[model samples]
Target: MEHPILFISLILEKLGLPIPHGLIGETFLEKMCQPYMTYTWFVMIFLVVVGKLTLSNIEMIPGKGQNFWEMLIGGMYDFFEENMGRELAEKLFPMIATFGLYIAVANLIGLIPGFMSPTASINTTVALTIIVWVTHHIIGIRAHGLGYIKHFLGPIPVLIPLMLFIEIISNIARLASLSIRLFGNIMAKETLLTILFILAGAYFAPLPIMVLGVLVSLVQAMVFVLLTVVYFGQANEHAH
Candidate 1:
């Protein structure tokens, strides 16, 4: 089972890509059944089983996975508490945590054999960005009501229309920036890794690239999460 770009791209869209394109031309049953019967499925299943077993045995002792999870949760908690305040952070924790976990896990999944990261696709990143954009505005309206619109109007009457126009365009630009940044970084990393493997006989040359890829993956996830926080801050700011 070769995981070609087309196949990977198709699976990503099925999971939830923002762009409109038919990646997989297969019926529902075929897609569902094929996963369970494929080699990738076996690897996934094996990892799940091993992960569970490892956790079970570590009931009295902390291991790498538990430590990593703790660190992630603690870091996010601190970040939100500082920026959003404890009450608001608590209120928004579920949404923030879900996005962070989903994206972080998706990025990490790419490190595994045969599985591609959905975040590597522009469609997926764009969809996520749009959702964030909508969520920020909705939260803003709910919090500040009509005043949410005032945030775009600026302080001077003469600049109201101009400010509004600027705000709207800037918000739209976020969608393109977020999507392109993620897609370009992931695609470049994958392409570089392939070239390295080909040129340096598969093992030694890919080592450094793989290490860099992991760092880049983590950074991308962090960037996405931080940008969401910034958007939330802007949307919820009180217009004076």
Candidate 2:
């Protein structure tokens, strides 16, 4: 089946409108196709659509169509400034802000009629967590040289083996925690909303759930951003 929302989003994006790509339909032709399509093609498609939309409106000022983008950019900048200091924030802003915007937009997109939040998927969350985990270590090493590994070895030489093991486990847990937290919350919200729609099918019945979904989306976005900042901070600290 053709996704009308996706079609409309594509058209609007072409015309330089502010419509979000998440309004599009998300269905696989069969259950067997769901795993492959959802995990791989969906991310690729999302990147392409959002990339085109972003590039097309690059020259536009803050208008009705562009207000959301402007708000997101402004908010992330302000947040970075508050947490990371102006200099560091400016240096790291591009990477952090890009993650925040992409994730926030992706989460909010779920509230739209047809689209599913990719963040709700375990595959997406796990992949993102892995990337973040690797990024944290890479930055730490770059900043501190070989001494970055020393952080895990502890301040004392005798504790090196034990400390290293603990650090490694903790890092692995970070990935699991981040992925599970995001996936569980989003999936739960989606499931609850779906059940509500099934049970009541009344307009007002789903309103409250939808509102909650919006809040959850924002919270999830903030959590991801905050964790990113924390990870960066840890890396920078070791570097120093």
Residue by residue across 159-188, what tens digits does model 1's lDDT show?
987898997888789888877887788767
| The 10-residue segment with the lowest total lDDT in model 2 | 28-37
Q: What is the lDDT of candidate 2?
A: 0.70
Task: Specify the highest-lDDT model's number.
Answer: 2
Each prediction's TM-score versus the true structure: 0.74, 0.71
lDDT of 2 by residue, 141-238 (tens): 88789888876776788987888899889978888898899889887876676676667856668788889889998898789989988887787675
> All models: lDDT?
0.69, 0.70
Give the clashing residue pairs of candidate 1, or none: none
Candidate 1 segments whose C-alpha is farther than 4 A from its true place: 1-67
Q: After superposition, how far is residue 79 of candidate 1 from its true place, in Å?
A: 0.6
Return the number of clashes found in candidate 1. Answer: 0
